[model samples]
Target: MELKINRPTKGVELCLDLEKRSQWETLEARRTELAKDPTIDQRLSGGPVTEVAREITQLEKEMAAATVTFTLTALSHREWSRFKTEHPPRKGDKGDEALGFNEETIFDAVIPVSIVSVAGPDGEPVEWAPEKWAPLADEMTTGQYGDFKRAAFGLNLGEAAARLPKSLGASLVMARSDES
Candidate 1:
């Protein structure tokens, strides 16, 4: 299984290359390999674990390619304002600053994430979170945040990733932003 991960410093020196691969390749590889393994061999089910690993590698690569979304904290008054303007969540009642993730105002920086896996217990396949995700929280103090234990979190990463082409995660992100 080839995988690419997002490391701010490319944390790991060694890694696999799965470029020139498509979703169909991953989908087909697992399907074909598993179909051929009728016994569902423990060593090689080529199921979710394998598939998610492959895709996470791919996601890391894709997310790493992002020219934007770099993590920053301790911004100048101007930089902080600019960041807020760019990621505005919603409009204020009137004469208010745009709202969005303003973590920089408080925290050192928003952690740059690289989603690796979100599979099921069997590791067959499920909804996957993108490396760049708007996480949900239990409290509705501000934005829409989901918990890792939430039912929505149960969707395996594979299923989540498979929907990337259709921008399901994007939908979730926008909604999350609005909720905040």
Candidate 2:
């Protein structure tokens, strides 16, 4: 019997809930503090810990309901290779070699190709395009953009590959490990 190797077509799903996420974080912090409070007995009915926990659970449901989800798939070997070749690092104005690939450039190039689908909070389909990415990215905070870029890269490359330092050499390493 011959063993067959399938291409990486499976998509990774990532969700973002900006509004409810902050509230969830605040509630989680309150729960942690309540867990340590001597006055608030965790085993007692209607205690602070239990109340905070309940709030957290409710907030989680709300967050899930409000979240925007993205589905991303890995690029084929040829496609990824061509992208890297097209976006090679360049020299600075002073003729110094660039330290690494630009994060924005990487995100801009990779995200559109990697995306399979996008859905809004209500599960309505959201239109996605390469042109839309820059404007959307501009509206996001640095942390938010980083999170999205990380997810996109992680789907196209392995998580380990995505997290690798953004050096020219690192790009080569990622391409070599495309099938992993």
Tell me how candidate 1 scores on lDDT. 0.38
lDDT of 1 at 177: 100
Model 2: which residue pairs collide? none
lDDT string for model 2 (25-117, tens) is: 998998888888888767797877888889999988776776676766677767776776666655552221342344436667887677677
TM-score on alpha carbons, each prediction = 0.20, 0.66
Cα-lDDT of candidate 2: 0.68
Local lDDT at 95 for model 1: 25
Candidate 1's TM-score: 0.20
Q: Kindly give the stretch of ten consecutive residues in candidate 2 with the minimal lDDT sum.
A: 93-102
lDDT of each: 0.38, 0.68
- Candidate 1, residues 104-145: lDDT per residue as tens digits? 231112222222333333333334444334332222222212
